[model samples]
Target: MADLQDERPDTGHVPVGPGSLGAEDTPAAPVAGALDRAAALLAVHPVADGCNTLVWTLRQSPYHDIDTPDTGVDTDIPRLRAGGVGAQFWSLLPPSAGPHASGAADQVVSDTLDQIDVALALVRRYPDGLCLALSADDLVDARNRGRIASLLGPVSGRTLTDSLSPLRAFHTLGVRILAPGGAQWAREGLTAFGHEVVKEANRLAVLLDLAGCPPVAACRIAGASKAPAVLSNTAAAALNPHPDNVTDEVLLALRAANGLAMVTFDTARTGDSLHAVADHLDHVRAVAGPECVGLGAAFGAEPGVPRPTGLTDPSGYPRLLAELLDRGWPESDLALLTWGNALRVLRDVEFTARAAQHRRTP
Candidate 1:
């Protein structure tokens, strides 16, 4: 743990990573403690047969508490790891400056890819004890063996700059899905469509479709993750209306594509703020058909940040599932929203990538 309390190394202003592992990084197996807790949850809730305890992991690297002032104040490193909280997949954001003339967002995509290369190398070296799960099935398998998975994605989608090539670059680097906006849209514009909208929704649609971007994959502590961008979803209800939430035009847009529509709700934020997004899901599913709806829990382990008015964290996931059940969502339909659909996207990518690799080798 490097005596973190006394040996607080002055790295000026740096983001969290392996260094934060602190005392927990000891060979004594800090994960063992988290395993013990998972054991307890498994004993009571017990992920049902053929069921999965989801970890809708996010990568808020640059924006994590430390940089956010009020949040970085006295974070508990050991406790986070001990809880075996949803796998902390490194959600690396790109740099604001330095790189090419193609524009700032594309530059970040390149820089972030470099960081991913480093992270991947570490996982490859410690496959037995580290990983980057590409699918929920991979997460279930890794949990059975006691390892963490790292899902790859940018906290914001601005890195693509309304371009297809950048999205391709990120996908090539194993970044399967991404959420387009963070507090607000990047240098681009507002995330939600408004009475007098600024950016083009069709452009956002083109970028997501090109990236095959979705929140279907998370990270692991050992090897690589596997998953897909099965469908596109957004939680930008405040500044932007969620097209995935459903309007005839939006529903037609989503229905036209073969993917899922995810409604991500930040428990730390007021749930009412996301109601527009949620109700849209209800309407979209009703009008577009059941296969299109999905859900996301945008939770942050950092303290002080309030959980959305309705949820309590990963433990609260099943409650939402129950709500969907109450609303007459079939078990099969709920499964697709909760895990199945995401897994299929990942598996498809893995299969496609491997097939291409095989063809190249031969």
Candidate 2:
């Protein structure tokens, strides 16, 4: 709320097609004073970011670099605390450059594990600032304690070694979200192995991420109906046909499947400005419903990838919150956008998995 009237981007009425939350339809909350209300809103509702490459965030420090792995100099801790981020789905990305790219299955597996190790090690280095969260409760508890709950997730399904064992192993290593490998897996919408994995994930409560892939047959069956599925850091093609936007058909499928579509902030994928971000969100809300919306903000933490205006860092989150409020978004719905929905989905996935495990225990 830092004099947002001046700093805030002009989020004018974004005209969307049928099924969208039109400007006139958007409802404002009955709260006095914008800044105080925004703070109060966050105090009661924890802000959970759907996607962030925190490992890269750590590298933002001059003392660290990917070529050299040293957890000495720090930035992410104080930064996140200042930003008011409660929980984050920290993506463990395999090396896509240099020697070990995701070319072979073995490389993907090994690199993925290495990424996990680094991410966990970083969390371990800052115990007071960050907590390794494996469940929905863990995330909430961490936030309650004024610590950032860190959840580990693989950035690619290709790292699974084409087997279920590795997938289970990752789960055991505290991965509660997954995106299974293969383009053909989505051909029939869901493949046999994909179905098996989805059932296992459902039974285990591990959330499946579709990345930006359309909510195809597999997404419809596994994500929409069975368990919580996330479309992380993808764009909405209906608004902007950027490489990252998901098609209108996919957005509809996501709604039908009850899946969540997280909007990213990287301008390369989402176009430019916070308004662009808002447009995508409005489109998704209109077509897929607000429950299907979450903020990924793919703030790579490092450089190279340009961030959208008005939302340059973790702290810029309040700007988005304020903008949504200005657009007449209700507090209850705002809570869902910030954290509630993701937590609910995670909890549902966890409960389903635990129940399945309980049934098999006998």
lDDT: worst 10-residue window of model 2: 10-19
TM of each candidate vs. truth? 0.49, 0.81
Once superposed on the true structure, which residue ranges of model 1 sit more than 4 Å away at CA?
A: 1-107, 114-130, 135-140, 143-149, 154-173, 178-248, 267-270, 273-281, 301-307, 350-362
* Candidate whose TM-score is highest: 2
lDDT of each: 0.38, 0.64
User: After superposing candidate 2, which stretches have Cα over 4 Å from the reference?
Assistant: 1-32, 56-62, 65-75, 95-102, 181-184, 214-218, 221-225, 358-362
Query: Model 1: what TM-score?
Result: 0.49
Error (Å) of candidate 1 at residue 130 is 6.9
